[model samples]
Target chain A: MQISASKWLDIWQANRRLTRRVIEAFPEDQLFSFSIGGMRTFGDMIKELLAVEGPGIEEIVTGVRQKFDEHASYQTKHELLDKWDAETARIDKFWADLPSEKYLERVNLFGQYESSVIDAILYFVENEIHHRGQGFVYLRSLGIQPPFFWER
Target chain B: MQISASKWLDIWQANRRLTRRVIEAFPEDQLFSFSIGGMRTFGDMIKELLAVEGPGIEEIVTGVRQKFDEHASYQTKHELLDKWDAETARIDKFWADLPSEKYLERVNLFGQYESSVIDAILYFVENEIHHRGQGFVYLRSLGIQPPFFWER
Candidate 1:
């Protein structure tokens, strides 16, 4: 009944793909300035995702926990997309390298999240979808149609 | 390192609890009428979750597919909270009845989604988080602060 690593990767990839589409739907001017309540802008939320997932997955692979940091600079939407593309590759590379059983092994992720790799990854994917949902709301408020959820 | 059904239930319960909090944070007037672009209101979104999860779990337990239908009448925020509580119990009842191996079995969920029970459940959890994220944005737009997401 255990889900294989490949299946987990597929789930992660689908969620990330959808999130990327959500990011692309954001208007350039609104991406960083739009805020709901006191929540960080969509741009800031995306940075948090970039900061967390890539390093979290990499640490899961290397068994070396690094301090949580927003590693890459994100200035323009294009830059964000570029870095997002790079991080996409990073996920495929490191996730492919992981031994299947390692997914079931628990790790203290980034000294913050402590769970098995699979659960940790689920948390990662769900977190992105959660934020992207915010972006969807933002786009709708701005009169833009956010991408469909199932398109990913 | 395989996750037990109990663990998955724990994850589901935590998510549902947080979602219930998100529901509580909504202003009465905004729950049903607020829409960004053309998306459903928060009330509609929560009803979808209520419709899906309780019955989805029941379907898995009985191996009988049922059409997706919104079961509860949610007129007021209090009614919504009441239904949420009932659905929480419904999940526990059906989920507890399921055999552990059923977690790996595939069901044609609502005659739509075709995936293993675990994936279906994960989809259920993620979908709620996604919509709740939308509600968070709505609250923010109304200058209302959403309940902290991590409180779960």
Candidate 2:
């Protein structure tokens, strides 16, 4: 394998850690309201990420498909962070349930995206990084310094 | 291998194609002058990408260290696109010279970042996606629709 399953997971977790820092850097008031160029707010983007990872892993572990949902409401930044923390643990559990061979299996992710398990996992991380990049701009525009991109 | 080296190269090329589309979506003048919230212009980001991939691959192929440079000035968007096209071809040639076994070897990329060749290559793609996400915001702010992220 070009990369072992564990190494790839480690990379994904590192990215997740960086993303969490981006989320924490946002001012609470701006978390949901701030946006540039009609883009979705960082808060909305985080919800989309929260919607995907844990449920996506669950779907991968079992044969059941998940409906993509990004409309969960977290009335406060604290609430959002709580959910984010919970989802991280849930993802670890679901990920541990995934067999090594399943990494190569083709499955329909969220009943929307179709690809090998590996590709789907890669997309999950890529999507977060893309959104996080936008978050970085949002932070910079607000005169705040974002966490270093390579620190992950 | 979880993914063959050729398949990984194909993925990188696909990302390059999508990034090229992002570059094409920008107005010539705005390509260098337009940015939101004090971020670097998408053109500058493109130059950084141009500085990395081809040279990074060459470094991996020959054990040569490259000095990271993003200071090349292109007077027009056409010139930048021309360089982008040339780099794509150069990256392919350099990539072909890289033996599959070398994917697992560690080296200092740009005489700065040290990691296995595969991780370094992944960083190249992730960095592009990161900047492209910002470009998407720049385009939307300009009332121009950027290319779809998943089309890559």
Stretches of model 1 off by over 4 angstroms after superposition: A100-106, A112-116
DockQ winner: 2
Native contacts kept (model 1): 0.68
Here the TM-score of candidate 2's chain B is 0.95
Best by TM-score: 2
lDDT of 1: 0.85
Q: Please, what are the lDDT tens digits per residue for candidate 2 over residues B13-127? A: 9999999999999999999999877778999999999999988998899887877899789868899889999999989999888888887898988878889888889899999
**Model 1 lDDT at residue A21:** 90
The 0-to-1 C-alpha lDDT of every candidate, in the order given, reads 0.85, 0.88
Quote the positional error of residue A136 for candidate 2 in Å.
0.7
Question: What is the model-wide C-alpha lDDT for candidate 2?
Answer: 0.88
Reference-based lDDT, residue B42, model 2 = 95
- Stretches of candidate 2 exceeding 4 Å from the true structure: none
What is the C-alpha DockQ of each candidate?
0.60, 0.71
Model 2 / residue B139 / CA error / Å: 0.8
Give all TM-scores, in the order shown: 0.90, 0.96
